[model samples]
Target: MTTGHPFMQAHPHQPLSIAAKILSPQMIQTIRKLPEFHLQAWKILDRWAFNSPEMLAQLEAQGEIVLMSRLLDQQAVEHQALMDSTHQLQNGMTEHEILEMCEIHTEL
Candidate 1:
């Protein structure tokens, strides 16, 4: 890891901790609202450290930071999709507009 990355510097021993902290409030709330099985996965992640086997596996495959970033990105995409779908349903959005919104919300 670079010595100057702010997230890494925030908690060298637990960089992913800083990753969680830096997330938007919406993202945190979405995480809290995750299903029971997903919440269990979060518990497993919470117990992981830089040297943990799972972390090490991710590190070896794509580097830890990249893996964490991708996970966060995926979560954000899923959360946005859920929120957009809910909004569309609540507003009785037209099929054409809903399709446009779906295209706009495509994941990076």
Candidate 2:
């Protein structure tokens, strides 16, 4: 925990209220589009005061952030794969087939 960190100066009782104000519109939009699991993880990260030593220690003990980050990374890889597949299919695949492929991908 750094004393000079922005979260250190954040209103301790407000959680994400101050943090949300600092996020760019594009960043917020990107977060909004995340899947429910990842969205929940982001919310947890957003709500924590990382600059407080006690909170930081507790967070490290919980290991939630590391798990969330790994999950998000895996999701990004899957999303990129799907996007690439969709682009390749756009050459000749029918709309119905594309939709079906997306549904199938999501099921996994």
Candidate 3:
């Protein structure tokens, strides 16, 4: 809400960044230091906010904060899946064997 925040340094005619208004200053700094993929995800969320102001406000009013931890949890799951597949391949498991282990049926 402070006009002196870095995110508020936008051109006089431009609106302040959504992250500045919604996220804590520490959160903004941390997000700025995150990887490109994470930054892209934030950009997507910001666009969603721009497109759905009323919904965002309603969620905020209800005390619903965005859960970046869920994203990290999902990333961990995906990374574990990839590591498992890589290990299987290294152990000479054929693609068919891996697919079968994963219960994914495919027509050869």
What RMSD does each model have against the real structure? 16.3, 16.0, 15.4
C-alpha positional error of residue 22 in candidate 1 after TM-score superposition, expressed in Å: 27
lDDT of 1 by residue, 31-106 (tens): 4564532532232233333225454344425643554465455455544554667767477654234434566332
Give one digit per residue, the lDDT tens place, for model 2 in 10-69.
344543343245444444455456564453234333534243435433434556455346
Off by over 4 Å in 3: 1-16, 52-66, 71-108
Q: lDDT-based ranking, best first?
A: 3, 2, 1
Select the stronger candidate by TM-score from 1 and 3: 3
Write one digit per residue (lDDT tens) for candidate 3, span 65-93. Answer: 34344334433443445457998769766
What TM-score does each of the candidates earn? 0.29, 0.27, 0.33
Total clashing pairs for each candidate? 0, 0, 0
Deviating ranges (above 4 Å) for candidate 2: 1-62, 87-108
Best-fitting candidate, measured by lDDT?
A: 3
Give candidate 3's whole-model lDDT: 0.45
Global fold similarity of model 3 (TM-score): 0.33
Residue pairs clashing in model 3 are none
lDDT of each: 0.41, 0.43, 0.45
